[model samples]
Target: MASGNMTRQPSPPRVFVDVDVQRDFCDETGALYVKGSPNALFRRLTEHAVARGIPIVGSVDSHAWDAWEFGSNDMPAPEGGKPGFPDHCVKGTPGWLKVEGTLPPRFRFIPNVPHAPIDTAVRELATGQTHGVYFEKEVYSLFANSVAEGFLRELSAALGGAPEFVVYGVATDYCVRAAALGLVQRGYRTTLLTDAVAGITEAGVAAALGEMQAAGVALTTASAVLG
Candidate 1:
């Protein structure tokens, strides 16, 4: 995906947190498809970003094959994965790749690998390659990544005042919920783009959204945020 004619980050530019819009979570053929999610809407959201020059912090889940999630080596369930969970997003595999068009070429990308020295998020944002920081996460929330606080701090210091992270993506009940609430907890005014995210279950989505609202996470739509 190319971000055509997209430049000039918005003043008090909005930080878009794209959480786990990966093949494994959005594709029916994937190992952990999120019930009814399709990548179609995410593609539209990507186009909206390119048109709006909104820098996106794209996050992906990268797991090593030996990760306990796969039940490899008799290891207990991976820290973030559950027992009996099908092996998905294994490092260097197609399933590990971002969902189609979610990662525009102009966006910086990071794969959250386990035990990798240095925070991939900090390194990517520090490079200034793109206004957006795309990094990997080993856990459900970006905060679970070692450099999460640092990454948020970098954005805040660079942008002046804390950057408001406009978040969206798959599994609204889980990763999306965690990211939104975590951002709020970190003191960043976080907004969860309602329509941009999909969930594993309707009941779960409702519950998560309710919790996020109570936690002070602004629930809005992409149109409202991007406009």
Candidate 2:
């Protein structure tokens, strides 16, 4: 669908959020790593966001062993009982874990970090009047699927009635772009944090960025978020 901006609408408060930029997606050592994710640019973008107090949300692709995307009666499982099409982000595996030191220790430094979701990490601060909210988008856009919408609404309500969402992450052409577009359609001012994101392919990234621009989502860089 096409997107447009209406000039009369009052601008809302803005913050930075992202799709799956986890170890599984971004690190070469990870199971389902994207080729573009481990670059210095992505590190820089993530580092910059950590330095600022901007509320950062991340979408994680978590699934059980029997999910339809991986398991079907007709298809046999790959070696080690894993799927063949992609080898990553498996539930409870090290590859499924977030990258070490990607964000500051504070973000990941909980008593029980292994089971904690991103929402829990930011919930206390986000609930406070001055803090920005955080949420997770498991499937496509955080707003694309039903589960994500529940969390999105809770976060939105916490941050008052209106909020501007800036997005970044791995596989820019697909998940990241879709989430940003979804946010825009929901009447939020959306920005694409280009540098912080990586795509499966260069062409895919280029095309998605073009589509996002055409849709009236502002294209922004991590540097802009940092400074």
Candidate 3:
């Protein structure tokens, strides 16, 4: 028996965090394509989320022509001066665009700028007017965008609680790993869809999985998640 005055509590949010699933990483002809990555699986995940009305948060590597991370540049690499990567995902390029079906019809792109205002971003997302929210990043981690953390925090509060993040995307060893670990570190319950992600090498993927598992990120497959 229920009391007439009793009210139901709002359910905690569950969001899908799509990490760097752009043409450069997932398509065969792109500059930095990850060979043997299950790109179709990425599309399936996105479709499922849209059908279920789950919020989709994503990141894109929006680099410049002479960005320091490019191997063509003489500037030091982001990771301890190591050699940089081949040119890929340059701003306004075809390869920088999100793969077909991964982007929602109603989406907002958050630029990577210092001290960007987050109030409007949070309101737009929390109000259900925007189905997808994307963060343009200059580095492997979306956290590199100054407003990302603040936007997420405020979005969580607006939605009543922190989200349980379902993460999947390209290059399991890099952006996916960073996003998963960062979410967990920021007190979100994060889960990685293993089968849906593609990596540069088997060794790198295995190492990344181990590291993610050690840091309390749960791992599963697309089949498990979508089913």
Candidate 4:
């Protein structure tokens, strides 16, 4: 079952990738809890994929103590983890683990695999030679860090030279949307798994979908992504 807007281009293998599904992103006790996050349904969707022997790629929203960069449209940097939202997944803490319910026993966790090294992982994933890349990001989108030439080149390679990409994750408008559009600009076929994502606010969720469509990122449901 191909998800999102099925591209005419060849399938890039069954890479079941999840972005920032960490305590700081998808968990209810996360630093910045989205409105409907920690959603049971989203977890179930992931569980379904993993149970089917799909190579699961789980991303954690990892951050260093002093790693505050720019802020998202909605979430600003915390005075500390406590002051902003909730004390949460600092790098190397228990809170940094993936959201429990969505994970499978076979799900592989890759921490801070610098974007430079992602190309080989992506090639292996595309060839069904390995599980997909478990991508992490400190801020919004993984692609936002364009200055890293190594990362940029790797991303270009992972996208399989396609004109569009499909993405889904926590905080749709802020993080997920940024990643999707970023891929779009990089000339990848872009889409969003609408039902699988949640936002920190109702307005943000609506805004994300609207903007995604406006930017030519197809809006789709989990069924589309998973089926």
- Which candidate, 2 or 3, would have the higher lDDT against the true structure? 3
When summed lDDT is taken over every stretch of 10 residues in candidate 1, the lowest stretch is 120-129
Tens-digit per-residue lDDT, 112-190, candidate 4:
5443445555444443344345555556676533332343345445545432344666878777777777766655566
lDDT of 1: 0.73
TM-score of 2: 0.70
Better of 1 and 4 by lDDT: 1
Candidate 2 colliding pairs = none
Highest-TM-score candidate:
3
TM-score of 1: 0.84
Clashing pairs for model 1 are 112-136
Error of 3 at 133 (Å): 0.9
Model 1 clashes, total count = 1
lDDT of 1 by residue, 1-227 (tens): 22356465667767778888888988888988987674777777776766666657767887777766564456675354456567888867998888877776555554454444434444444334454565677667877766556667766665566677888888899889988998898788888888888897889999999999999998788777656
Q: Quick one: best lDDT, which candidate?
A: 3
What is the TM-score of each predicted model, taking all chains together?
0.84, 0.70, 0.91, 0.69
- When 2 and 4 are scored with TM-score, the better candidate is 2
Per-residue CA lDDT of candidate 3, range 1-227, in tens? 21233232236767889999899988889999998768788788877766666678899999889888788878776567644789999989999998887887778888898987768767766765666799999888979888898888888887788677889997899999999999999998999988888898899999999999999999888899788
Count of clashing residue pairs in every prediction: 1, 0, 0, 13
